[model samples]
Target: MYTPGWQIVFLDDPPRLKPAARLPRRPFQYQRWEKNIFSRGKTHTPVRRTVNICPMHTLSTISSRKSTQPFVHALAWFVYASVIYSANYLANPAIKLGDTVLFLVPYILTFYVSLHLLQVFSRLGTIWTIGGVALFMVASTTAGHAYLFVILPKFGVYVFNPAHPEQFAKDALLGFLLYFSYALLYFFADRNIRRRIAVTDLRHQGLKRELENAKLRELALRTKQENMLQEQAFLRAEINPNFLHNTLNILHAQAQRYSEELATNIGKLSKMMRYSIQTTEEQPGRVTVTRELENLQLLLDIHGLHCKDPKLVLMYIDGKPDGLMVPPLSMITMVENAMKYGDLTDPENPVLISLIMRTNELHFRCRNKVMRRTEIASSTQRGLANLKRRLDISFKDRYTLCNRKDGHFYNVEMIIYN
Candidate 1:
């Protein structure tokens, strides 16, 4: 069966009664409620209430719009070159072709040459930078000298003059001045473009991380659901809930005609069995701490009906459970172990179960007096083994379990860090 993608509510379905909280029909719902259930003498909830961690948006589509600065930079330089050529062309209409070669060609060449020189300077320091600028100046001046004096004159754009040696100085100075202005503009433009690219990369990384976490959670849920379904099928085949209910109802009706105490205990037993069945089938790794403790009290009450000692067990709560949850049946398994092999006849040293909840942690300790060799058989502790396995899958290493045998008692303590 396909489990709901959001969350299972409370892990409670008490046989014939309505569930404590209803499960939503749709998959991947945005808001998920924590394991919040139960009310005994007071109300308190201490868990993370709202789980809004659902992957809602598409992560593959990185939100990196191409920066418009590049296009703007190209246009600005184009206008700069055009304006110089236009003014020169208008002032001397007959020499239109010469003005294009004189102003536009050197200016465009200077812009690109300065950009390359700046990259070399930034990366390799002053030594290599000096060589790079010298190389650029020589190459650009030689090309400019040839275009203006030899090439342009061949096309009837300008006349060559051997006497005007001052013309070479003017062309070189003009080229250096163009380079200086473009370098300043390139510095700011390059910085801004790099900042935009860095921001886009950071955003893409964050989205990628979130998508990965979402996928891992989904896979865990699928694997856990499959395991639960297999166990539920096995359980259903071995024992039918409807048949148990009918048989319990019949026994209860007959016991009520003879004795009220027997009938009352029978009803409680039926309820406990129903709760146990539902928990195995429905737990979403965890069940409400409050609800599990309440059922624990019910189990104790049932045991009380037959046990001779009035002080069979003691449960102490240092802080309110709030809405905290633990792996289903973890607490119950500890109690079951104590009831089966612990000495409960003595009123002073009874089974002691204590729970302490703090700001960011929870502590649980179960201690009981061990029965003598004559009173109890050898124990295999299969229940505690299964509890550890369940906890490994649910809480991983976030919780700690320790069990030790004292001189005459057994002690088990667990700590869950929030």
Candidate 2:
């Protein structure tokens, strides 16, 4: 694609191709050599692989609990009344239906009234609870008096003598006894239930604390492991290279006093070494594109200085690399690979390299003529694989790298997003 500020500056006169000859295709890419294999006589299209990432979350589920006390109370009341009625039947075998109904009505009222009064005053403190007991006694006595004075008359059974007023006091005494007994039973049962709930809450708190402690310990271990790995990597990257860099600087200075050419080459090598040692701090696995191009040119100059073919490799860079940060050795590895395996003896088909740095991204392409005996380019895939790994460490999925090879030439392309 043609873009403003993009140019192709060849180190030699660029070769002209036939009108029908187009560049070879690239393949799916990310952190590896994505091959785009083609059959000798058939055509194929390349497919880029994509990775989909999603976030993860943890959801806490709460189970619902229903109270069974209401059902239990109903069952207990039924059983108590049945046992009492059965006992009365044994003592008074001639009891009538009206008499049974009269006994049950008063019993049910006293039981429920005591239960409800306790429930209402349970949380109101001891003073209110004592008052509620007194109030319950009065209520039960009043209910008993109404049943004795008015309800029994309807049944024509168990008549209370109006002349003997002591019977009223005795009836109230009986009401107090029955009400207190029922209140005590409900009070004890409620206190036991509350104690169980408190114990369960404490257990849950302990388990929660233990889970939090385990998570903290795991985090600490992971942090320590990461620190160790970072230390090892730092040592490997900085130790030997730093020593060589210093030694080369000294040699360049000394060579300047004897041979200008030797000093220039040594200075270039020293700058390349320094850039490699220091580039990562600038942008994390990146150096200024200008620095990379300078080092790359120096490498080509070194190739020409040492080899018979000075124009075997041709590099073309377009657009300003002003603020752009390219990964160190991004293009140099490709040039070296081409030099190692390509048929650079044929001047007509030199190794071609091109780069374009746009507003927010970069594009790079390279091609090399394959040797006559080689069926494919990049036979071992080492240099490209290493380049892929380094870029992935820096850019992750924000970059693309792919390659294509026919019987005679190999082509590679890479795109990096800022």
Q: Pick the candidate with the highest TM-score.
A: 2
1-418, model 1: which lDDT tens digit per residue?
2222333221111112244543333211233334335634554443233332222232222122235646876787678767766777788766564456454666577777777676646444556667887787777777777777787676666633657858766867776766757774775575455444444544565799899999999999999999999989887754887578668888998999999999998887787777777777784678878888888887788878667877778888988777777877788778878887888787889999999987657898899998777332345267777888888887898989888887888898888775
Cα lDDT over the full model 1: 0.68
Per-model TM values vs. the true structure: 0.43, 0.65
Residue pairs that clash (backbone atoms under 3 angstroms), model 2: 7-318
Instruction: Summarize candidate 2's per-residue lDDT along 31-130 as a digit string, tens digits.
Output: 1123346535454434333322111110011111125556776787668767766778898888764566576677667767776666556544467768
> Pick by lDDT: which candidate is best?
2
Model 2, position 260, has a per-residue lDDT of 100
Q: Which stretches of candidate 2 lie over 4 Å from their true place?
A: 1-65, 95-113, 147-172, 250-266, 283-286, 303-312, 333-350, 367-412
